[model samples]
Target: MANQEPRVLIAYGSKYGSTKEIAVHIGEVLNKAGCATTVCPAGEAATDLSAYDAAVLGGGLYAGRWHRDAVRLAHRARRSLRKRPVWLFSSGPLDPSASEREIPPVRGVRRIADRLDAEGHITFGGRLDESARGRIARMIVKSGKGGDFRDFGQITGWAQTIARDVAARTGASRGT
Candidate 1:
């Protein structure tokens, strides 16, 4: 495992694309850090984790729960994910809270993290714009409560941490 680049899967579920962008950013960081990374939506990711050495899964939070697709993927890939290093993340807070301090996973997400024995978890601020779908989403935006709050620097930092952990665990460092 130390001789070759670690293959990492980054799976995410997003409602309005912000979370997808976050996942992509993470993949880029991991790739630059010497890991082979695949970033895909949770629903599209393969259920088998046999091909990857580690995984980072994230989802958009909704009504205090994780995205359905992400939750389902975790259930389907639990056994395989358990055999590898797994990290989880949530993006849903529409304020600066996520960047200011640690946000514990909601009940459902916490359960998924526990089941997968995740190496770590994070909560990133979310984004809501006028283009958001659904009545409630539009209402929130119309009420002037929605805006992009994701912190890319914080996100990049977290991804770098995961890359280091992966390299340390796999005994391989691609770039250095």
Candidate 2:
């Protein structure tokens, strides 16, 4: 199976669509790098984790919590995720500082990733559109916050690293 390329599943939960966009972008980067990838909302992803050789799981952070669906997906796929390569990510900082240090896991979310032995976790910047804001969101925006903080270059760079790791582990790198 040295020649077999690894398959990846990208699962995400988004309260208002930011995380979903990030997940899709990750999938695109991996696919372009020669991995087969499946993208879906965390709730709709397969429970049979073995179907994917690796996984990239994440969701938006809101009110110091990971989305419920992201937690559920992790629990449902726990066994498989533990046996394979898994990475976790969260999109939450309305601030532009999306470095790993800024991307703290919300409440109980860290425990799930620790249990799954995920390889790494990323905290990317989030986007807030004023037009889509509810009254509360509007208030937050009015207080001098809220805008698109997502960086496509940063997202693709991380996914590219994952692609390299997958190829190395599976011995599936092209031009070999």
Candidate 3:
């Protein structure tokens, strides 16, 4: 039998590209941990969920909602993904102080994740560049004391954990 390492797909949606960068970092961590990984935008990924041993979905949150593409993908693949391992993550909450608070998961996205029985869920801090944001987004960010609030260390550590978990599960399944 062939002993191929498990394949992991990191799919994400980003408004200003911060979430895309986070997905790329997660893909790198998974690759370093020995899993084959690919990172792509949720709207552009053409691979079927069944082809991957594990999947990570990340998106930017706007107005307490995850990106539309992320939500759509989750719902569309929920059944096929139920038997596989999945992780859900969001990039939002620009306030560094807000990071310490127990912010509830975004409602619509959380429902999809719950249905899939995802292995883990996380909400990381996001960035808001007023110069790059659209009119409404710019207004919102400016109104809220805008600043970049991403925590790279925390993101890296969580990604490592996901990689480890994927490796272990894939190993155990092969043994069985």
Best-performing candidate as measured by TM-score: 1
lDDT of 2 by residue, 1-176 (tens): 57776899999999889999999999989988888899999999888877778899998888878889999999988988898999998997888788544566765777987899889888899887766557877877787788888988899889999999988887785521
> Candidate 3: what lDDT?
0.81
- Model 2 residue 25 lDDT? 94
Best by lDDT: 1
Per-model TM values vs. the true structure: 0.97, 0.91, 0.89
Better of 1 and 2 by TM-score: 1
Model 1 agreement with the true structure over 1-176: per-residue lDDT tens digits: 66899999999999999999999999999999999999999999988889999999999998899998899999999999999999999999999999999999999999999999999999999999999999999999999899999999999999999999999889994642
Error of 3 at 45 (Å): 2.2
Candidate 3 deviant stretches above 4 angstroms: 1-3, 172-176
lDDT (C-alpha, whole model) for all candidates:
0.94, 0.86, 0.81
Q: Measured by TM-score, how close is model 3 to the native structure?
A: 0.89
How many angstroms is residue 54 displaced in model 2 relative to the true structure, after the best TM-score fit? 0.1
Clashing pairs in 3: none
Residue-pair clashes, model 3? 0
